[model samples]
Structure formats: structure tokens, C-alpha cells
Target: MPSALLPIIAWDYQFAPNAQKSRNYLYITHTPFKICEQPFLLPRPALLSLGITYRRVPVLSIGKDVFCDNASFLDAMQELLEREGEGRALKRGGADRAFEAWGYRSFWVALASVPAGLVSKELGEDRRELFRRF
Candidate 1:
């Protein structure tokens, strides 16, 4: 019997480290939450159900409380833990991973079009190759 919370994720084909972090943070915290994944251009029911003004990745809902925003998710966790004097610490606090963007367009948008892979599959082969370097 785990405490349940709704986690709305932006599941788009484009690969965004920032977006990945949005979902990764939740997994790292080991929080029990129900994931509500959304596709590109925003999904309807989720927006309507949550009354989302700006549909983005990682919308969270607890009972009747609906919260939409990635930057504030961590704050919400801390607030919840404070009620019980508990807190969660990220395990890979010092993990070393890097990203580099050369030229104007980072290419994330281009590679996203490739098929097969989640991000590439969504974005198309021609476009994926164009942004492969980034």
C-alpha cells in the first residue's frame, strides 16, 4: 500500500536532458507516484482534467490538488516530507554526465526524428541525421 500521487510526464520524441531530469528526479527520490505521461503538443484529457493552463512535463496531482510545473516538484517533495519530519536524498548526487551543444541549434530537435529509438523514432531519420552530432 504505497501513497499515491499523479505524475504527469511529457513523453515526447525529442530528447531533452532537462526533460529527462524531470522524470529522473522522481525516480531518484524513490517516491511512489502514478505516472500520467503526455505526448507531443499536449494531451487533451490531462489538460482538461487538471485544468492545465500551460501544459508541460511532470504535472503532479495529489487527490484534488493539481500542480503543474517541473521547477517546483522538488520543493513539493520537501514540503510533503516536512509533515512527517522525513526527507529523501538523491543517491547519485555526484554522478558525472555531460552534454555539449555546438553551433546554434543543439541538434536535439534534429536527431529526435530518427525511427526505432524513442526520441529518434518520434522526430524521423532525415531529421535525426541532421541533428546527430548534438
Candidate 2:
């Protein structure tokens, strides 16, 4: 079974770093997939339909199975690669974890540094509501 025949869907906000990370990982592994770009605000109907209430981007859906969060997403991708006999193409370890943590911290810092004037009021309110629990 060729990888392209499988339905791999990645859901994320437009220009999201997490989504970009997923794309890079897939590209490096020669995985063929599609991305469903979403809006920054709420009402993500596709994700809601999948029963994913978590407010985050880079959600990966392979067939009926969905992998949310970076860890699970990477694990699933690795599994897929292994199943396809491409296991040796990429290796995972503590370095990946450290990079993920650093990337997330940097992402937050960059987001925080964005000028208020450059961001719309609705986006600001949306993010505040979404990340209120954090």
C-alpha cells in the first residue's frame, strides 16, 4: 500500500509553528499528506466533529484514528513510518523532546512579543479564552 493512498489529515491554524513542524517532519520522512488550515478563533467544526475539544493546532488524523498533541502526533508518525518499512529513515530520542520543549517556549515568547496593534481584537480574545486554563 502506497502512503499516498492513505488519508492523512493535519488540522492547524494558518501559519502555526506546530503545523509547520509536523510538515517538516513528514517532508523529511517522505510522507504524503494534506493540511486543513483553520482560523485562529473558535468554532472549529471539523475538529469538534472528531470529538477533539483540546484547543491546539497540529492535530493529525490518519483514517479514523486521530492523534492530538505533539508527542502523540510524532509517535504516530514514527509508527506509520516503521509500518511502511521506513523506520531507519528517522531516529527519535531525548534530543527530540528537548527540541520540542525549546520550540514551544520560543513559540510562546515570539507570540507574546507580537505587537498588540498587529493582532486583531478578536484573535486576542479568542486566544485568551482558549488558553485560560493554562
Best by TM-score: 2
Index of the highest-lDDT prediction: 2
Provide backbone clash counts, one per model: 6, 0
List candidate 2 segments past 4 Å from native: 1-6, 130-134
RMSD of 1: 7.4
Clashes in predicted model 1: 6
- Give per-model TM-scores: 0.48, 0.81
Per-residue lDDT of 81 in model 1: 48
Model 2 lDDT, full chain set: 0.75
What's the C-alpha lDDT at position 20 in model 2? 82
- Model 1 lDDT per residue over 1-134, tens place: 12344433443223444456555665666666555555554344756665575544455555556556544655555455455344564422222222222321455565446465454544443344344532
lDDT of every model, 2 decimals: 0.49, 0.75
TM-score for candidate 2? 0.81
Clashing residue pairs, candidate 1? Answer: 112-123, 113-123, 113-124, 114-120, 114-121, 114-124
